[model samples]
Target: MIDAPRSRYQQVADLIREAIQRGDYAPGSALPSQPTLAGKYGINQTSIGKAIALLRREGLVRVIKGKGAYVREIPPISRYAVTRYAEAVRESGTARGAFDAEMAQRGHESRTELVQWGETVAPQVASDALDLTAGAKVAIRKRHMHADDVPVQIATSYVPWELAKGTAIAEQDTGSGGTYSRLAEAGHTVERFTETIRSRMPTPEEADFLRLDEDQPVYDVLHTAWTAEGRAVEICVHVMPTTQWVLHYEWPAS
Candidate 1:
């Protein structure tokens, strides 16, 4: 049996992908206009649009409504599960959190914008993770994290109101080492962390905040910080774009 011919859009997509791989279209550079691509490929604008859409879904390019499509600039960031949470690094006083330390080590400028910080009723997830009552109050800290000035992740942390009340964790800055450090200072040292991760398409708000195209998906990570006595001290929700991150993990083979 012979293989059938590929569709026009598929062919166009392949050509464009090849050009991108060959560096003809540099990362963060705009691709040719639809009309130009159409004329150059002897294809209609509809096919060109479909081709670009296909590329967008493949994580090769991003489409801007008024500006047109551009090659995706952000490289995949490797998230080291274990070392990122090292107590020594947090106590070093040079970085605020794992995100800041990792970005600085990678030679990228890191920034955190405090979106919301205050006491609020615990959400179901937070309540369950922190073993709090359904209507229990909790201190909330929401931050938008950036690397190289590009939006990368959103982290929102929740702690039992009594634990965080009148503490630096309730403040916008959280001093050094971030929430974990403050928790340690408050006699709730985190001995270990549990993270549950899932992936889904970005919501309208998340897409807008992260500047993500419709085709991009995001990782929702529920992180629970626990103490040596097995009490949950903090619950944090981390949302990151899938195209911009690669989670890494390692453990002893004992």
Candidate 2:
């Protein structure tokens, strides 16, 4: 059976994408206006709009409010490796030390800003992950992670109030080694971590926060840190733009 012909906007979008890739439209350079493109292609202005919208959805372009759409400058790629969780790295007293190392390896800089800090009743999933009863209070440590000022990931950690009550984990800053290192000093050593991830379109607020295209997807990761005694010490949820990160895990062959 023959496949259906591509839609008008799809064809134009593909053409524009090829032009961008071929250096016809340089990165950070604005594309022609919708009316201009429509006239150039002898198509309806709506079709031009639709084509630009498609490009935005693919992250090939970004629309600047009050201005216009421009070809996007793709950022350099970086890896989120399983080895970032190594004890040696965490023990060095920078909870983010692992990420910083990875970024440096790629000639990028890593930074974090504390967004929300204090205590809250553990949300259901966090409650269960930490093995606490529903409604149990937990210290909440929220951060905005960035690569060269480009917002990349939002992380929220839920630690049982019992373990964090008098510790720095409940503060705006986790201090030297980051939360895990501080937890270790407080008798809640993290011996292992497990992460589960899923991808979905971001919520309205999340898209705005991450500065993502309305239709772009984000990866949601649930990370659980466990103690040697088999107790869950921290339950962290990471919201990362799918286009901004790559998760890599290395394991021995079975």
Residue clash pairs of candidate 2: 93-176, 93-177, 94-177, 95-177
lDDT of 1 by residue, 76-148 (tens): 7888878887843654552246788778778889898888888999999899999998999999988898887
Worst 10 residues of 2 by lDDT: 87-96
TM-score of 1: 0.87
Task: Name the lDDT value of residue 200 in candidate 1.
Answer: 88
Best by TM-score: 1
**What TM-score goes with each of the models?**
0.87, 0.82
- Model 1 bad stretches (over 4 Å): 1-8, 87-95, 213-215
Predictions in order: lDDT:
0.86, 0.81
> Best lDDT goes to which candidate?
1
Candidate 1 residue pairs in backbone clash: none
